[model samples]
Structure formats: structure tokens, C-alpha cells
Target: MEIEFFDILSKNGPVSWSPNTVKTRLCLNYLAIPHKTTYLSYPDIAKNHKSLGIPPNPKGLEFTCPAIAVKQSSKVFALQESLAIAKFLDETNSSNSDRKIFPNPGALSLALLVQRVVDRILNSPVAKIAIPKVVDILDPSGREYFIRTRTEWFGMPIDDWAGDLEIAWKNLARDVDIFSKMLVEAANGPEGGPFFMGSVPSYADFVFVGYIVWLKEANEADGESNG
Candidate 1:
């Protein structure tokens, strides 16, 4: 059965630019799952999810992207949240044991920690650099909604918040340096491992990979080089 992967559409249409969705996509790819994508415009998110009968998030979010609908035994099951979706895929695909996102008992805990660190420490600076660029990539309604919501959330206009690009880049560099050191310390088993858990990629790797993907796209959109 094919799974329905719901992802956000970019302003130009049919293109996706969401990090959370990318995380779930990576998990599905790793598991070799057969899936089709449904792109949702920002304005259609709440209406579409509601029409599809998806439940509200426990965090009180009315709607979110990266939802999946899977068909089994002639019944359809829908799920939300990137990490939860990844965990479900890992648990359901028992034969693909080697492709598990969480490979050990302590893996989930450590992955959650890494996710928290990225979200809490690194995301803000990155957002300061990225949001201004993101506005141009969103559709008209999406751009309006994004600007209003984000401006309200940040207690200032996105342009104003992102005004100090130099400081934001410096802060991002500093936090990235800290993360680089942590990655080095975490690497104990191999001579050339690119992931947090030595040579093997885990949920922690996916978490940061999502962020990196977002950063890369944002930089590209801004006509800036990641280097």
C-alpha cells in the first residue's frame, strides 16, 4: 500500500521547503517506503487537515504539516509529528531492522536531547537569518500569514528582527562551533564518522539534518553561500 505524505508547498507551487517534512521524508526514504506526496498550501493547511479528519495536536496547534496517511487492510490511518511518524515507521517495519531510526535503548533519549539543543539554542539565530528570505518564497496569503504570525511571535517585524545580519551570523557560528565540538566528543568508535552516534546515522542525525537542510535552502534563497 502506498502512504500519503502531506508536505507544504512553496510559493511557486509543487515545491517543498519545510524542515520537519524533510525529516519524515528522510525516514520514509531510509525505510524504502512507497509513498506519494500531497502538497498543501499554507492557507489550506487547517481546512485540509480538518477535512481529512486529522486530530488536533496535543500542543493545541490546530494544524501542521508532515502528516501521513497509510492504508492497511482496507483502512486508512493518519499520523502527525515528524518524530512520531519516524518512530511509527520504525516499529511497523520489523523486517527493516537495520534501518531503524532509534537503534538502541538510550537512543531516543539522546536524540530528544540533541533535538532540544538544536531547537532551543541554534534555531533562533538561524531564524533571524532565514525568515526574511523565507518571506519571498511563500505564496501571497502564506507570506501575509507568516509575516503577521512571526512578527507577533518575535514581538517585531521580521525585517526588523533580522536587521542585524552580522550579529545573527556570529551567533549562529558560535553555536555551530559548540555543536561541532560536541560531535567530536560524541565520536568515539570511528575515524571518519559524519553522524552523532559514531558511523551510524540515528534519529539525532535526522534532527540536525533537518535543520541543516533548512539552513542550506535558506542560504540559497538568500543568494548566500553556506561556506
Candidate 2:
């Protein structure tokens, strides 16, 4: 078999708290894909994103830390956005063909629902907590923009910062409850596995794993900052 190669862009030693980045790494690990990580500083990422074809965000064109580059036919395809990258890699590799990482016709509906729930937490409440951390590291002056963007996107009251934090926590708790129930259901299945699809780790597994790490870190930081 020809050796498969991938270039994963990451911060904090290839696998830290960035779920999207970690998702890519975990999926690669699961697939046994040989890869190398290119650790880029903030300045390097900013300078290269446009050439890399990554769209700019408040985080800048670096695409929020965990961008991936896939090598095929001597050309590299750089992908930003976690789910898009995950689905693309899953489909590209044959080892994942039978596994169905992104779900299929039968499970597609449930997968989408799970995806939405995951996205809400990651982009909403989780983002509420994390944007500050990112801004602290990447753009201290842009903190207001981060707050305003999250508030507007999540449709939360602009003045109610404490209220927004509470809402985020409540929303996250509901999601965790739903996930716990699903995990229980999955674990009891005929095949028996800790993944959503019972025997195989699907897209939900990667998505859930990413968020759990983020939520935990955020919670820990909240505790330390207060204490």
C-alpha cells in the first residue's frame, strides 16, 4: 500500500484543548494514517491562512487553531472547519469506508441532530467561555468583538454577561444529559461499544470527544479564576 500522509496544523504540542484539532488527530490515529504536525505560531498562521485557502474569522484566517492539510497526488489540500475536515478525511480514506464516521442513510438523521446539539455548545456557551481565552492569547484588543459576536449569534442579551454565562451552563447541562442518555442507549446495544453507533466510533464520537475536552477545560478555568 502506498503510504498515506497528512499535515495537521496545531497549537500547543499537536494535541491540547482544541477539540477540532484533537478530532483530526484522533481520527488520524484511529485510521492509522501517518502524519506530521506543523506547529505554527499566531503570526505564521495569520500570514499563511490566505495562501492556505482558509477563510478568516474573528480568530483570523487560521480557522480557530486546528486546520488540516491532506496530501494527495503530490498536492496538499488544506481544510479548515472541523466537521468539514472530519467528513472529508473519513470519506477519503478507505479504512473508514465501512466504519461510517459521518453516518449513513439510516443514521444520518440522528447524526445531524447530534451534530446540531454539539455545534450549539461549541459555538454558543462554550464559545462564550473560550472566546475570551483565545482573545487573551491571540487578540486582547478584540475581546469586545468576540463578546459581541457571540452575543449576537447566540441571541443573548448584550448587557447580561452573568446571565449569558448561566444560560450557557444550562444549555450545556441539557446537552450533556442528552448525550449521557444516548451513550447509555448505545452501550446497551447488541454490538456493545462506548460509541454512538454501538460497535464503531462514528462522527458523533469525534464531535463529542472534542466538546467534552473543551467543556472540562473551560469549567476548570472558571473554577481556578474564581478561586
Candidate 3:
């Protein structure tokens, strides 16, 4: 049976904004897993997950995007959180041994490091640039929910949180330089390639690719060239 991939979608608009969701999607594609996406609008995310019997996030959030439900034999498994889902898929899908997501013991640690750096550091400025555009494209209800939640989370209005794009852009450039330097140092080792893990794409590559995909979506929304 095919897995059910739950993704956050904008009502009457595109559904590729969430970087976490994109990470799981990239993992699924790289593993050649046969799955189908079930898109949910922002306001409905928590309710939909509850209806499917999925557990709430341990971090106390009501729900998160990028969940997956898989039915194997007589058992059904549902999971939330992008990294957990990706790790699960990589370990469980034994058929694709050659294209393993983790690759090795050290690879998992490296991948987690990259994921953390991107999520905790690089995403701040990117969110400043993208979240406003994302909110503008959502449906009325979704927009309201997003604004309220984000305002609370950021302790300010989303619009004001990203004040001064010039500074944000400069910060983003510095973050990108740091990331590029790390990649270059990694490549300096014996193993090197266009991807994160030598010649083959790994979970690390998917983590970075997710950010790239989000940037692409944001650029398209703003009528800017991603190049």
C-alpha cells in the first residue's frame, strides 16, 4: 500500500511553501517510494491530524505539517515531524539499500548538523523575506490563523518582525557564505561531489534542497528570478 503524505497547502494556491514538508517530499522521491499527498490548508492542519489519530507534537505545538501514514500488512503507522519521518522511511525501506538516506553512522550526524544549522540559523532571514508573501497568498481563514499564531510566536506582528529588508538581506548573505564555507571544507576531504555526501544525495542534501525549494517558491510568488 502507498503511504499518505500530509502536506500544508495554501487554499486555491500552490502548496510548496513549507520547507519541512518539502524535505520529506524530497526524501520520498529520492527513495522512489510510491506515495500520495493529502493537502490540508493551514487552519485545518491540527484538526485533520487529530481526525487521522496522529499524535500532537511533543514540543506542545498543536500539529505540524509533513506527516505521513503508512499501512503495511495489517498494521498502520502514522508519524509527524519531518526529520523523524525521513529517518523512518530511510530505515524501513529495505529495498533501496543502495540509495540509503543516512548512508552511514557519521552521515546521520552530519546530516543532522546541516539540518540544525539551516533550521536554527539560515531560516530566520529567509522567513523574513518569505513569510509575508506566503501569508498574502493564503485563503482568508488560513491567513488569519497564520497571522495570529506567528504574531504570538514572534512576539510581534509578522509584518513588523521583518523590518528593514536591507539588513535582512545582508544577514542572509553572511549566512549563505558560512554555509558555503562549510560545504567547501567538507568537500576538501577525500569524498567530494556536487551533493553533500560525495557522489550520492543523502538526507543532508534533502535538508538543504528543502530550503532551496522554499526560496524558489518565494521568488516565484514575488515575481523574482531564483537565479
Candidate 4:
């Protein structure tokens, strides 16, 4: 149970700010793992992670948060990426093995499939709406890093990311309609409702909810900023 959860900090605090970190938080909640969360600014992620001896990511950014340092007996190992971390938590479920994320072997595939679909279809439109407001939620350090990276990533400034609110909202609604139809098709039985897998929530639910939580929060921040 000796674990340290690293997450990005925003002005709104550390509970459920960043979508990626929120996914980790959801997985941790699902596992009921006791861990202390350590907040870091955007610039601090690379600095602190390298100092911590956490290896760079194989694919994208070398260092990122929503990471965990798990200690067993004498050795400490670090893990990053929300889905990979979820798999780890599932494997290490010593307490409630029956109540699990991967109820069957095929569930892992399902979760991965759902995650891919979420990343492809929903991430951009939602992120387009969320990123600008997210900048308002960060302190100077995090804000600066967020703006620079996002500007390069999006090929435009933060303000321009959500420049046309009317158009952005319309586009978002269209994407959401497509996504909702997906959920409807999956809702086959009485067990189905909010979750992708009916009443039984899974990692896929957490993955989809992570983006949505941030979107909702970002819109809240947008309103607060306007007022």
C-alpha cells in the first residue's frame, strides 16, 4: 500500500482537474488503493520524474504525470499511462478479486477497444473545448507550459483553439451524438444504463468519464472566467 500518486496541479486544486489524472484517480478509487497524491506543475513533471528515476515513456512525452510509484518490500517501481496503470491495479487486487475491472480475459480487449474509440472520436473535440479553459485554471508555471505545448500541438494559440464557441459547440454536439448512438447500441439489456457495460462499470467507463469530467469542469471554468 506504499504508493505515491503524482498529478498535475491547477488553480482549482488536485481532485479532478486533468482528464488523464482523473482517469488514474478513478482507477485508484475503483481499486480503493491508499496513496498520497503529490501535485506538480507542468514544468515540474519532467524535472521531478527524471529525478525520481522514472524511465521515459517509450512512445510520446518522456515524462508525464498521473503516474505512480509503487513500493514492495525494498524496491520501488514507477508506472505511467492510465490504462497501463489500470491493468496493474487490476492484477494487484488482493482484496476484492471478484469485484474486478477485467471480469474476464476478454474484458481487457474490450477496455482497450473502447479506449481507442474514445481517443479517436471524442478526445479532440472535447479537448478543443477544454484546453482553453484549462489554461485559466493553471498557475503561471503550468499555464506557460500548457500554452506553449498546446499551441504547437494544435498549430494555434489557446484562444484560437476555442475561437468560435458557436461552431465548437456545434461540432462537439455532433460528435457527442455519434458517441451517444454508440452507447445506445451497447445498451442491450436492463443492466445497461450509464456505463458502457450496463450497471457494471469498468475501465472503459472510467476512460470515457475522464474526458467528460474535464469537459464539464472546463465549461464551469469558462463560465467563471466570463463572470
lDDT for residue 142 in candidate 3, whole number 0-100: 80
Report clash pairs, candidate 3. Answer: none
Per-residue error for 163 in candidate 3, Å, reads 0.7
Model 4: per-residue lDDT, tens digit, 13-124? 7667777888889877887778899998999998888876888899889898789999889988887877788889888867566677777676778778877877787777
lDDT of each: 0.81, 0.60, 0.81, 0.80
TM-score versus the correct structure, for each prediction:
0.91, 0.67, 0.91, 0.90
Encode model 1's per-residue lDDT on 9-64: one tens digit a residue: 77656655677888998888888777899987677888877776888898946689
Over 1-227, each residue of candidate 3 has an lDDT whose tens digit, in order, gives 55999987765454656788998988888888888888887889888788778988878686898999899898878889988998899888855667888888878898889988987888988888878677766778888888899999889988799898668678888888867876776677577766776666788888887887777676567577635
lDDT of 2 by residue, 51-155 (tens): 667666645343455667666677766756666666776677776455455556645566567778777644566665554454333233334455566578657
Candidate 2 vs. true structure, TM-score? 0.67
* Residue 173, candidate 1: alpha-carbon lDDT: 95
Using alpha carbons, what is the TM-score of model 4?
A: 0.90
For all candidates, the clash counts are 0, 1, 0, 1
Shift in Å, residue 176, candidate 4: 1.5
- In candidate 2, residue 201 scores what lDDT? 75
Least well predicted 10-residue stretch by lDDT in candidate 1: 185-194
